[model samples]
Target: MSVQDAFAAPRSAVRDVNGGTGAITDTVINALKKTRPWVLFLAILGFIGAALTLLVGIAVVISSMMMGNLEGMDAEIAPFGSGMMIGVGVLYAVMAVIYFLSALYLLRYAGAIKRLSSSLSVADLEAALEQQASFWKLIGILVLISIVLTVVMLLAGLGGALFMGAAGL
Candidate 1:
């Protein structure tokens, strides 16, 4: 589809290469079958990674708390201030949640493919597409966030450099 037409067309107006309403062809089915395993694998990996991250987050928080309670330790002696450690732990926990959600979306998409394999129903195909769309949407949002964060960090670094220079440091 032309770029103009693509933007103008509604989802229902989508057409296949043969200029017909998008239909699940045998090729499409085969592709889905081939890809299902990869999708499932990704989902499993995400789940595992998220679980590990969550564990790390919890451990970090506990360690920080324990460090704060140590009688012989002073703030200057601690590797990191308890507040900073807690903040890092919270960030890790938030990342774990995001990772888990991405994994959940992939798992649901895989399930849709499994159903389509068994039934070859248009409904199943639609469901699979919806799940796939959700996964892509999440990834797109994450990409945007990463870009913004990079820009912010760069600006902050530049600002710090200028400040240090002005202070004759």
Candidate 2:
């Protein structure tokens, strides 16, 4: 994708959707109605997944604390296990937060669709599309964050490996 497209708000949401007196047209409403069921289902699924993620994070942290005593091991090594587990749990918590927010946006989008279905007005249509746009914008930001984090972690791992090799560890 071009730099402009990459940086731009989700194309699907910002793109001009032609409409009548209201900003959005009938065709947009028709399409939204068609996707309403799927949108609702996805939002519900996201909520469930976010809850599970949070639970897993709590479990990890608790389990790590319980198992952190590397009994009989060197003091230097003992902290590593606990720290890694805690870090992973924290990451999971962060993921859950992002997941929950994304789901909320989706749920709101679905609500907008419902509103449009009932009112069939230009205002309702515009609001519904705005919700949809918000959802996509969040998802795009999350993807970019994930990519950066992955690259950073990879580089850290590589750097550690090189350091170890150089030190003859």
The lDDT leader among the candidates is 1
TM-scores vs. true structure, each candidate: 0.81, 0.80
lDDT of each: 0.89, 0.84
Model 2 ranges with Cα > 4 A deviation: 1-20, 23-26, 69-74
Clashing pairs in model 2? 19-25
Clashes of each: 0, 1
Write candidate 1's Cα lDDT for 83-163 as tens digits.
799999999999999999999999999999999877777778989999999999999999999999999999999999999
Candidate 1 ranges beyond 4 A from true positions: 1-23, 76-80
Query: Alpha carbon lDDT of residue 95, candidate 1?
Result: 97
lDDT of 1: 0.89
User: Worst lDDT window (10 residues) for model 1?
Assistant: 12-21
Native-referenced Cα lDDT, model 2? 0.84
Q: In angstroms, give how far residue 89 of model 1 lies from its true place.
A: 0.7
